[model samples]
Target: MNDSPGWASPGSAPSDEPDRGTEEQPTPAADADGPAAEQPSPPNWSKEQPPAGQWSSPGIPGQSGPAGGATRARAGSIPHQGGWYGQPAGGPPMWGAGWSPAPQAAKPGVIPLRPLGVGEILDGAASTMRAHWRTVLGISLIVAAVSQTLVTVVSGLWFQGTGRKAAPDGSSTPALRQAMRDMADTLAGSAVTSLIGLLATLVATGLLTMVTSRAVLGRSVTVAQAWQDARGQLLRLLGLLILYPLMIFAIAAAGLAPGIILMATGTPEAGLLLMVFGGLAATVVSVWLAVRYSLASPALMLEKQGVIASMRRSAKLVRGSWWRVLGIQLLSFVLVALVESIIQIPATLIAFVLDGQSLMDWANGTADSAGWTFLIAMGIGAVISSALTFPISAGVTALLYMDQRIRREALDLELARAAGLPGYGTDTTSAAAPGAPTDTSGDPTPGS
Candidate 1:
């Protein structure tokens, strides 16, 4: 086989020709009609056969050799005896006489410059946080704090202004009105909080993606540096963020539309059944689409691509590994959820304790507003949870993107050169490679 690292492609097995330096060499034969053709012909296979077991298999003991009947053993050579079927007597068998271990991949940063396993991807994310906490946590903290504070204020005002009271006479109509008001208030509060969180997530994801990219090359980046590097694409990222959810919503709406029409035409039972099935189908499709496009944020930030192009890039990378990608993304989500629950649950209890009367009033539908103590406590919990979990979620996504590229496109080679490893053929004076973490400016350019 030609000398190259890693496994050779199929059908390129080792050559079977004997070494040229061997003592016995076949001489070139003369023309068929020459005088040499008068020599006796070799016997046919059926006419003359050796006795059973006369010749041992190659590389086995008792095999005849050029030196006579003596057996010879070569150091580091594969033995082909037949005792344990194929295993050696003492332990596992070696590969072969010429076998050598492959070179260890270069690891200049959080991960080795090669395709990654699930554990390695997660570990790389955590390592980025540990290796560059200053930048990573700083970005998350600022975003979470600002967003949580706004959410707390909005929630307090919303609860105060929209509080509903039960009917004094125990009338069903007043109770229904109260329920409708509660629903409207809940929807308004959720929308405000969701929008705030989305903005916070956009900023944190963009900044942390840059940090994680540099960390992969064993480089450190400051908060300002990451922001500057990511600023150009933040608008495009915003567009992507908005577009993705809208797409899912549209899918769900389309699924429910027919059911709504059926109900309006007086087929309530059939309409409800159709809605159930359609909603389930729509949920499955939405989840599939979510996993398919999960890596778009990192692609947008790192590759400087427009929204649609980045999404297309994500789709291409995830095409063959959809289930694997889904598993990893789900694992990250579970981990983030666990962390949030751990932090927020205690904070919620503390908030209840701090304003037990308000909690009781809210339960009885008598409270007009959330107390400052409760709002502040809950906000602190949210801030802490978001601050810690943002880095993890963003880092995993960025690393997963890199890992896919490494597996499919040999991006590790570019990463190695970008890191300026000794033997990766990096040219010190040349411009940065395509996958290198360079500062990009201006808006993202559109592409397919």
Candidate 2:
């Protein structure tokens, strides 16, 4: 388990028994060696060479020497090629060779309390869902049902029928007129749905971020508890949600407005060129800003920051890793889109088949469609799809925020401690604690 402690267990302590002698005495050799060559000067103890049965270097042997009974191997020596590591051929073994280093602890939570890999981030999100399915799925199901119900109601109210006017030439043109009306209504409905969806998303993000914080510590959170922790930050998060898109819209509009005016005044060629070029430029800026402020909501909810402050915090966190963050976010979005399409496409096809109208005729608003049946069926499918999608999207966003903090702030250590792992102090605070002061002694702020 990744969360398992790296330290050895207590039972691994070495014994303190003293060493014993096991030397074999040299025989007299029947006085044939002529007094053993004058007893050869006693070997020096201070020389570089080790005594017999001792190691010189990793693989080299030292000169032999006489000793009590038998020679003592040098202390704390590495084992020879095939030797057992039981009692070294010398004194008592030093402490701590009794056990191998303890296997690293399991991560014990949605993620290992360390810098996360891309797969780990995705896995963490899935892990959170699996661990707290009731809370996570409940939040998503409620939000999805409400959002999809609103869409169904809105579509029923505004999308069923249309009024048409005669052409300027006094010819009937119901198809063209109906198409125009459909387009207008669809755009209007999309705008309203987007607003409602954004509101739901803000609330969901707040609740899930709280859940994720607890999940990081391997603790499950209830929906009510999540709401309690999250409610205070929702307003600021919602403000951020509103303000961020407005900033993008404002940039795009500012870029395109001049070109629009020129085209309206009849400089079609120049206006077209400017519109295309300006749009491209605005797109580049918008994507950069999107990635830059991506962490703002999590920063606000987790750090208890104000709207503008959260934006600043996000900017601080994102400073050096823009491309990486952007890639990961884009990948997450693609996966979300894929999941939605997989589930919703079949539902939509089922709705279409059950509606019993020719595709062309229905699209042209010429068929007597089963309006409520179509709307309700589609709504149900949408609800199911959204329910499955919401948790993943929320989890990914929250984990990405944490991953960034881990990289920038060494947050994994704090998380490990918070998770009650060994080697980490039990009283240490969370690295993402709201408004926590950084240790400015030598620490580099994100900007630095």
Candidate 3:
């Protein structure tokens, strides 16, 4: 029931007659504790008007007026009363004698029902983990374990090489061919491992995005609920994941194509210069595209849109605020990187300790091979590290998408309704803050 500052109740002003110090000031006996002690009368705000140009508000006791003249009303302040406590004859005051600021929308989950700042977005992400640790961490653990195992197996099979020996044919050609074959095998194994990791990541992203959406509504969801919500559109999310990287690759190749042609035609020096500049240009464009469409996966999962539509949605949202979005995303990345390093460094050290010097020897080429123990320890470490990092990365992306929508589309009002906050949606007087736009056509919510 507290009124905002710069508003006053119907009364609480000095009396019409000049105030005599004797009545307004408390008698000395009023402070004494005895049968004869006099009690001071409380000021009757209902019958008084504050001093001219001063301010006070009902429900808020002891409000003081501005130092000089009347305070100017700020944007959201309620209008003041001019006379006695009786209600105005024409109608109710814009703010009744007893004015109160509107109640804030509740935040029972990750985010509040309002536009979010960067800190709030980060906090909401962390809160999702704290509130639903079992589901979030469990998903991450399984993905990490499976992906790490596959990576270890692939590395062992394809890249664990024996020492190179002199060519049997006594020519460098045989050695060169063998080295090239080994390189190709290594690249193939890497690609396979990467593909597996990408699939696991897509699944995790979809599931976590569902959880985050529910979390915004102060709702609890099980891993099963998350899976149910995400599975229908899982394929589309995966397609998005694949398509983005391919687009970047195509752009990069196009940029480098001219240089390659020039080099093939024996213009090596010019080709080198063109290659350097072109690669730089490609790198810049790639980053711009990446940041622009960074919200695509979340949009795809939440909006139930196709890969192309989600990408378009993200581009639209990011159109004018590209720099701000990029900065926030970059900050999230830096934070995630820091957390991953903190967790992985200790895990890697433990792996080294558990496996003695064999892992280091193999890494340094001082030994022909490493033992299974080294590989297993490293695999476990990788799993643990990935599990810890996965939720944070997923959470940041989801919340960032929500934040953008809140600013651009007034999605906060919709989220308030979805969260079942009272006095919102249809309650115009109290639905939104003063001056906030009123648009309540709901987005195609995630998990709907």
**Highest lDDT against the true fold, candidate:** 1
Candidate 2, 26-54: lDDT as tens digits? 85455674554345568667757664453
| Candidate 3 local lDDT, residue 392 | 78
Q: What is the lDDT of residue 40 in candidate 2?
A: 58
* Residue pairs with backbone atoms closer than 3 Å in model 3 (clashes): 8-56, 11-48, 12-48, 13-48, 13-49
Give the alpha carbon lDDT tens digit for every residue of 1-448 in model 3: 3111224454344557673334666456543555656566887677666444333455455555457433432223433322333333344334444445544546857887656788988889889989998998888888788888888887776656544333457676777778787668767877998998899899889888888887887777788878877888999988899998899999999889999899989999999899888899999999999999999988888777798988999998788778988988898889878877787777667766775765556566565444466677778877876777777788888988887787666667666755555545544334434343221233225322
lDDT for each candidate structure: 0.78, 0.73, 0.73
Which parts of model 2 have CA positions greater than 4 angstroms off? 1-106, 163-184, 362-370, 428-448
The residue-by-residue lDDT of candidate 1 on 1-448, one tens digit each, is 2111255432243578643333864666877777443555786669666533222344466666555665444333223311122223343443343233345678989999877999999999999989999888889999999999999998887776554555568576677777887888799889989999999999999999888888887888899988888899999999999998899999999888889889889999999999998899899999999999998999898888889999999998898789999999999999999999999999988988887755667778786556778899999999999999999999999999988887777777667766778766555323244344455432111110
Native-to-model Cα distance after best TM-score fit, residue 12 in candidate 3, in Å? 28
Q: By TM-score, rank the candidates, best first.
A: 1, 3, 2
lDDT of 1 at 164: 51
Q: Would you estimate the TM-scores of all the predictions?
A: 0.78, 0.72, 0.73
lDDT accuracy of residue 263 in candidate 1? 88
